[model samples]
Target: MRKGRDSKCLGSIIFVLVFCFAISALPFASAIQRQKAKIEKHEFGELADGIALYTLTNRNGLEVQISNYGGAVVSVKTPDRAGRMADIVLGYDQPQSYADDTVFFGVLVGRYANRIAKGKFSLKGVEYQLAQNNPPNHLHGGVRGFNKVIWHPREVSRADGAALELSYVSKDGEEGYPGNLSVKVTYILTNANELRIEYSATTDKETIVNLTNHSYFNLAGAGSGSILQHVLRINASRFTPIDKTSIPTGELKMVKGTPFDFTRPTVIGSRIDQADEQLRFGKGYDHNFVLNKKGKELSFAAEVYEPKSGRVLEMWTTEPGVQLYTGNFLDNVHGKAGKFYNKRDAFCLEAQHFPDSPNKPSFPSPVLEPNQRYMQTTVYKFTVRGAGRGR
Candidate 1:
């Protein structure tokens, strides 16, 4: 009888201890589960037309500040391995500075990205002439492209993320393009730390369209000096070679045994100074990589890793090509927080159809008719490596 009573007492004690422990852990578990994705809207500033700028922030510690003036991404803050957030995209502090920016900065470029030879292209036997802003060629949409236009803003709801939808209509004969193009761009910030950009367009007339975002990214945090120490891996076995004018020669050259080969995770500075014809022409890397995928699917394009911050940025896109620009011409330009942006201060991974694709019939076609909708999706997924707590 005594043994039976002792056993019952021990059992009762064990149950009480376990119950107390579970009760103590309940609040912590609830706190974690309550950390859902969120969206916060705030006024960034006012443009010349008095239109207000806006910002979006999600629960994953990612924030993007944008302006309707040109649908520019003014700032992007992401967390490092230590959970410390820092701005990684280069831009100006004042909104008006972007309006006067000679460099593309963090804005959208369109109509045609790269260059069109002699500022001319023949579409259906009609020779369209564009502004020769780049001297001998038409560059980045002919002086005033979509990057220079204001877009109307609309807020969208996502059950698992936050979104901002922007729309603009490109007038016929504007920038020497033939069609009245209607464009829609959506920016989504997911709880998984993904910055997804989806682009869609429809044209009234048959014309060529190539669009991309020009965000100078430095994973070590913007204004933190050279990104040469960073590692890059582009999923391409071939690349487009450029000419003296930085226009593609309409040839896809193999990257094997060449300085342009990034088949593995290699440091950017490893062969940047190598004596190669292509390097001399670009003055650095200002070329496009032929992505290894069918043009229709969203697949991995490239990845960049910043060792200092242990931040990894993986790019996935449906576009057939990616332009890797090393900011070779960024000289003495002023950026945010009293920092001077110089050559190779940052890099751009512009996902799009190949450069000068309209002229290169051999390349993927950028032509869109009245009935066909042009759609492209690119995602910049950020994640931190190393031991630390993630928000």
Candidate 2:
């Protein structure tokens, strides 16, 4: 009877041990289940006109929060080397603050991504005037650009990823731009950890269009700290310098021997404060780099590395220029997690035509005539330093 009792006790102990192992494996199982590609739509509150906000998440854990109002990228969550995920873009946690967002955050910039000299541009022999939102010049579309309006979103699921296609029709004379512009922008989150932005537009009349995503990224995680130590590399040997009012001076200045040089990998803060005239004008590295392109195709534009987290971001685009704005204007602004964001907290790489291109005849024309299509593609690919397949 004692031997029989001993056998029963040994069976009970084995059962307990097996149960504990299964319990410990629950979290891992759940994570594995999440790795399958899927898209989820969450109710992200409403805009003034009852437009809804939505967030899309993929199976690989790439999450993109967006609002129909302005088609803004509210946030982007990506994983670092340790497989720990964090929001790497700067913005407000609550969607309401975005209604009056002045810094642009992750909004879609357009009609023109940069500035227009003195809010004036002559197109097709007609001088057009725009709102001087940036004081001496017209900045980012106008006083009420695409960032300040709602869009119609059509959700689509692809074989490898999911996409949110946002459409908007801007009536002629809106924001002083002459065109009934119908624009379609698709934001795709792929299983390969890529955030792809595809823009297309057609105008009923001749008009200028330069679209880009204004996302301030900090690979160390948003609002965690400054991105001063982030290593940056751009494939451009030339950059467009800005004047006192932050408008491009229409000259493609060589970046060699200047603080603007990023041809070789360099820390962002290494020469940011150097006694250079261009650096002083932008308060940092706020200039448009002329992308080196061999043909009219997508090519490597820039790469940023955060050593602390081993997070690396590679930008590929078909556009000819990329505006590198080093968060120079962010100051004392409250962001996600109740964190205060200051200057140099993040950086933006906006892929588009050169700034003030409408005024600079020598620059690539941003004009779209009747029956002509405007299309631009930009991809932000994320990876860890030692990730074999570039994530």
Q: Clashing residue pairs in candidate 1, if any?
A: none
The 10 consecutive residues of candidate 1 with the worst lDDT sum are 44-53
> The CA-based lDDT of model 2 is what?
0.87
lDDT of 2 by residue, 319-357 (tens): 999989899989888988889899999999999898788
lDDT (0 to 1) per candidate:
0.87, 0.87
The count of backbone overlaps in candidate 2 is 0
| TM-score of every model versus the real structure | 0.91, 0.89
Clashes within 3 Å, all models in order: 0, 0
| Residue range 182-268, candidate 1, lDDT tens digits | 999988888778889999999999999888889999999999989898889999999999999988999999999999888898899
Point out where model 1 deviates above 4 Å: 1-36, 387-391
Q: Which ten residues in a row have the lowest lDDT in candidate 2?
A: 38-47
